[model samples]
Target: MINTHTNAQDLSSWQQKYPGVSEITTDYSEHYQISINKNNQLVITQDNYEESMIITDKGTGFSAVESIVFSDLFRIKSYEAYTLNNVNGRQKKTEVAHIADKKLDRQSVFDSDVKLKTFNFANLTTGSKKVLKYEMEFIDPFLLHRFMFATSAVNEKRTLKISYPETVKIDYKLFNIDKNNLEIQTETKKGITTITFQKQNPVVVKQDSEAAGIMYEAPHLHFWISEYQTKNQTHPVLGSIDKLYAYYHTFISKINQTENQELKNFTLDLIKDCKTNEEKVKTIFKWVQKNIKYVAFESGYEGFIPREAALVYERKFGDCKDMASIITEMAKYANVPNVNFTWIGTRELPYTYQQLPAPAIDNHMIATYINNNELIYLDATNATVPFGLPSSFIQGKEALIAQGNSYIISLVPEVKSNLNTIHDKIELSLIDKKIVGKGTFDANGLAAAQYRSIIGDNLLKRKDFAFALLEKGNNKFKLIDFKEIDFDNSEKPYSIDYNFELDNYLVNSGNETYLNLTLDKPYQNDSFEPTRSQTFDHEFLQKKSYQVVLEIPSGHSVTYLPESTTFSNDLLAYQFSYSQENSKVYLNYDVEVKQTLIKPKQFALWNESLKKLKENYLETIIIKQHEKN
Candidate 1:
């Protein structure tokens, strides 16, 4: 039997309070029990999780959804869910049928053993509720799960409990958790210890545009077993950086155990003519970047281990770890000293080894070269990034470098805004009712690398890509011909010289014609929302300068010009200048984004700086017929 007795007023109040929210978790609980396995390795013997949520929106009321992704290291023991109806302010539960357990191969020229388990609470109505319970077994103790206090949606009540025997020791790190809201209790009894974390409500989750990653924003707990005690002796798990490194060493120790003469000869032949160590490293790095294509694939523990160097070399394709392996082996074969195999986490995971010395903290691997105490990170997965600079995603991240029995942590340097620049110069002329121009554009550093990566070697996409980036004026603007497109030499900027015409860019009224001299305006209407809570992210720092010299039409005089303004502030610096000499009028626009994260506190300044540019973009230049004396 089924019954429906809903409270309209309560549902309406909830709907008004949390608009656009489809579901709200009323309660979520997770419990874990750790114990020693037959092999003396610590394992999660019992892992249980449950979540109960109420439907807040009519659309989502029809169906509630949940999923679990598992790899070889973790397996799901059981899963059950039920849809509960609001009957007389009480709950009546009905079983949810057809739980889907299937393999989902993430294929993009790659294969893996990862699988997905999903179920939906179908036929749910507004004000209805749902409950789900599941159990998971951790095959590997080192790869434990991090418990997040809440999702993007509102969480009313949440609890997490972990139980372990007296022989096991555990350590934890808390991120973005407020001490005021969190209630922690620890107790030991009957030769066992249990810890619990309870919270009524966390922060109001706000999904800001371009917000930092969830790991950086969410309140979460990451825990690991530091060590375990046995009747005979003690076994270390991951107490220090050295222990983590030692565990990682097991995966790569027997990788290239046998000689790889083919890879060695190939590497030797590739760098035979290189005279300097820098040259050798650059040569090897470029070879891997150009040759080996990156493909992600993981199976069992192979996800953490790098395959043999020779195997990857022969295949001509590998993932990040494999690429790191080859880059390291090749550099060593060429007699490059102080080469280190490195582990790093991209900006998405904002944790250092000292903060959480666990395998889960790092998601990427690279090869680093040390010279005069300067760490040169080489990430061959980025085919366009040059040797001296790291890929933008890893900037400001700590690199865990392997140096024989010990590890060194180094910070990847951030590229200066000036280094990654865009300087374009154009000479414009007023043709028959149109604007015609010949321009030369230069993009340096990471900007150049980004262009190269996008344009690649495809001759067909080059022109269209260039047009998309350089398109300005009006819809009828046309790119006539590319005089030059050079991306070969890393020493120089990625430069392009072309001729173009803006068909309807200028407005004319009798003898007077109007033109917006800030032709290539960037960051127009780029403003942060008032409701934004997190820091804004920029893919890379930028420095852009656009210059144009318009030849005064014959027998015409400048009647109106926008005032020039120049100012520099902490968030950004901008300049709009106009100068006239002889028969040509010059206009220059410059802007530099000085920092990566535009903090909420700097929103006003950031928006104001861009507002000035937007205001100038509306200002126009007027050319009137010269008055006869």
Candidate 2:
């Protein structure tokens, strides 16, 4: 039993104290009790409490909606909600009249047993308090739950308690906890151990513009049952990395790898004309990448189990696990050696299997092929990614490759900035009252792949996409004509040639003409917020080069030229240079970002670099008319 009264008077007092808080959490508590039942099964009982008060006049008459998700592994034992109102120093209570529980189809690709419980409290006026209480019983102790202390509202106090029998061993990890405000206590009695954690005036949850994931900044607890003893028998759960791998192996081992006749024949047909084993493997990989559609289904056991390769072949659609299975089997059929089923986490997750030996550590699956002592990771989810390049989201993440009796952990290599390059070459000249130019844009590596994906097969939208990519200067710039060359050829660089005109780009004041030669400043406004606490994630290394040749008209001569500028640091570098040769004024700009992550501590340096970059963009090239000879 936990405190349910929100105390409307206390909420009013808090309103005066805090001033502008939209809502305040009055009470938030959780208790979990774990024990071994007579049937030798581990059982967990959960008690939860949540209460909040609306403080501001802007928050009055707002509807409150609460939702909870559960599956067959857990059952809700009890649920109740109530509202308290303070009017003229009197307290009035109203119980919730309606609640709805319905099964949710998170994805249409597969069947799921997950359900969502939702209810609404309407007509919540100022100084109103709402409370919700629920209890759940876990049918499977292996499926543990996570508790987060910070939320959208300001939390005044939060308490968590866990009690377990002495015979059962549990492991817990605390993340992002503020040691200055957290309190812990432990007590043992009657062969039972209990641990309590309490915190007051916890930091309110604020969205960090630089954070890659909210979980990286929020305080939370992750605990799991490791081992238990019941009826003179000891059972091991997730006690170590080996045990975790073994448990995951159970799911992978169950996937039938026998290549059916259709799959074998199809794979053989795809590789029959290939010259080498590498080419054969790539042929099969590309076949699957272009054919199979990815449909993820994460409900109960369906999340871990991979459908048979033959079944997936028939359906032509499956989740990441299913895709991995089909690709692995197909490669084996093609006589490709060292084909491995690998588990990896995307950029959204910050944990590794060694740190947290649980399913939460990894959320994606791919096939790794070892050829000539080199590893080639393949993911069929993105049809645009070329061979030998890992998906951008999994770069630098750990890969848990499944071996026959053991597993190997390897780090995925990060793609170099030089490999993904964007080069722009333009020649500009003043025509009439507008600046007109003919330019060519070239992209290679991941840049090319990304452009191809964005352009897709819609022939009508290619010009529009090219215009959007080449947009520069101001809104008055327009694309007059464009042509895409080698865009469809993946082996070659994606190139686009376009001629554009900018209206009123050259301002004529008396004898001087002004032009801002900086066509595009991509990172001019990329400064991070000063108060951000989490590291910002950069998707990939990038290198950009721009060269502009301004052909001086017969009657014009350069009078004032912006000085060259260069900025460099370990993380990033930029160079802008201007020169004149005979009748051509050449401008070259180059930028390179060497790292894929910008830490919070590096924000100051990054901001300073941005400031310099913005200043360079503002420099203008002034030309004077030849005094009308």
Candidate 3:
């Protein structure tokens, strides 16, 4: 049996049981010549820089020590020091040297019962190569949370020196490094630093150190590191996979022994009420959604599968995994067709289930499928989301569908992008040097789902929110009324009307106040900045309609009016019109996007249209205040 314990004595005993294991011995010392400059990039090097060294050793079968030695050239965001004691929740600690001498209280960040503790700085010499050393008495038994040793001294170069006893194998994974500016020279057979510069700024640094034991009998151990510049060079600590698994097993065992039986029975019985499979499926979905709330619990093992289906059902609340498990069970009992449990990430990801070996491909979710074909991704935490459309986040992702023991099916979906759509009408009056107008705005299709997901079930509040959004501009404004807001679970489109008053939305110092007729809708902007520097490629099914009737103040003449503009691209379609007669100006605008994906080649064109529309909105209305007297 595998023994998973973090206690020194427990680990010591376990190590003695395994013979022929490679003794763990590591000596890692690195130097840095660091200084801050204008670009805010850390410049570090070994020969002329500050230095640090750490020596860690562990006999065969025992977790090995991790140590560090350093000089003060490292300008860290924050410093936290720890000295081990036999207190209630205290873990290990290092001998204090450069910073203040103190022991740190240890508990996971998400541990509500634990007091929050912080360290401001560390003890070390301020000059180059001023060595400070810290030794780990024993191999750390527990997994360290997200804490990685890192520093970002503006405009400095950096280097690392690591030495192992040639007993343990090592592997390093690097991400977000500028390959053009980096070079590596090492004695170890397979120790190398990798770099990726996808985006233009703030290079991301990542490294993974792993030790492989004998094949199936022994588990592989690894230490992961990631560094980036934060306000104070601070990073959150997350535990390792082995430690997490152990913590999860312990928690699940405890939770299983105690759960709500009535809630379980209620959920089980709820499935029975469905007259048909479809109804049963829908009903079960509704039950889970109404009962379970989405709460992320990534502290230690809390990130794993929940305690039990019965307990989660009784509580009516759980993380994504918990809710998914419960729904899976209910679906099984109700005979709502054949369904499998699966994993999925939100929409921002481009990974597929076929890439299951990529451990970090997904973080949350469980997909329910019918006869191993049609699929419905469910997220119980999003209580207000309608059936069919998973929250926009998980719209396109890979899902690990359970098939049988050691057999899981990988599922991926075609991208389901939200289309741009806006319908609006405005009534306007020219007053003094400004133009006052009231208008109504509406939405449909994926655009409606996006709004509903955010607004939830509070229809009145949702309407008020829309009105408030439309009230923004360079002028003082107010929304007096709204109408025709409705949601249809069965229909592909949902609609809403928002009414409001605008003041000085557009103006000039002259005799005329010009108003641009392009309507700004909620779906106009996509919030993703890709690293590859590629332009947006997804096409949007977009539509915009607006009608504005301007009541010009008596004796005021129109100076300049914008000619109607219209255009269409592989990814978009648009039209606009303006007319003047007597004391009223009539303006109508319509925009519709016909595609779902936009290629990089078309991004420049899309940007041009967007710029033109924004310019139209910025065009001011110039009204002569009293006709210049």
**Candidate 1: global Cα-lDDT?**
0.82
lDDT of 1 by residue, 177-200 (tens): 866668999999898899999887
* Segments of candidate 2 deviating more than 4 angstroms: 2-9, 59-62, 86-92, 102-112, 178-180, 454-462, 486-491
TM-score: model 1 vs. ground truth: 0.92
Worst 10 residues of 3 by lDDT: 211-220
Error of 2 at 590 (Å): 1.3
Better candidate by lDDT, 1 or 3: 1
Q: Model 3, range 1-629, lDDT digits (tens) per residue?
A: 11112355533543353333322111122322222235534333332222221111222222112222221221232322332322343433344433432222343222212222222222211110112232221111122111112221111224343333222222333322324534445443443232211211122222211111111111111222222233455332223333223332343344334435565466558866567666677777777776676565553355645647776766667777787767766665565555545556554344443322233445665646564455666666666556654554554355655443323444444333333355666777656545556666666545665666667767658656666556644446666665554554523455545445566566464544555544343234543323223324232245667677778777666666777777776656666677888778777777665554444455566667665555555443344435555
Better of 1 and 3 by TM-score: 1
**Models sorted by TM-score, best on top:** 2, 1, 3
lDDT of 1 at 353: 88
TM-scores, all candidates, are 0.92, 0.93, 0.57
> Candidate 3: lDDT over CA atoms?
0.45
**Per-residue CA lDDT of candidate 2, range 1-629, in tens?**
43444466666689887776667787899899988777888879998888877787663233487766778777788888877677566657777756898887655446667888886765577777778889988876767777777875678889889999988998887788855557988899998899988888877677776466767778877788889988778899985778778887888886764549998998888899999988987888888877898887767788777889999899999988888999889888888888878999987777777667876678789989877668899988867778888887898889988887698888999889898889999999888868899999998877787888778788888778888999988899899998888865665788889999989667789988888888888788788876677777777788999998998888889898888989889777899999999888999998888788787778888888888788888888888888664
Single out the weakest 10-residue window by summed lDDT for candidate 1. Answer: 54-63
lDDT of 3 at 321: 72
* Candidate 1 Cα deviation (angstroms), residue 293: 0.6
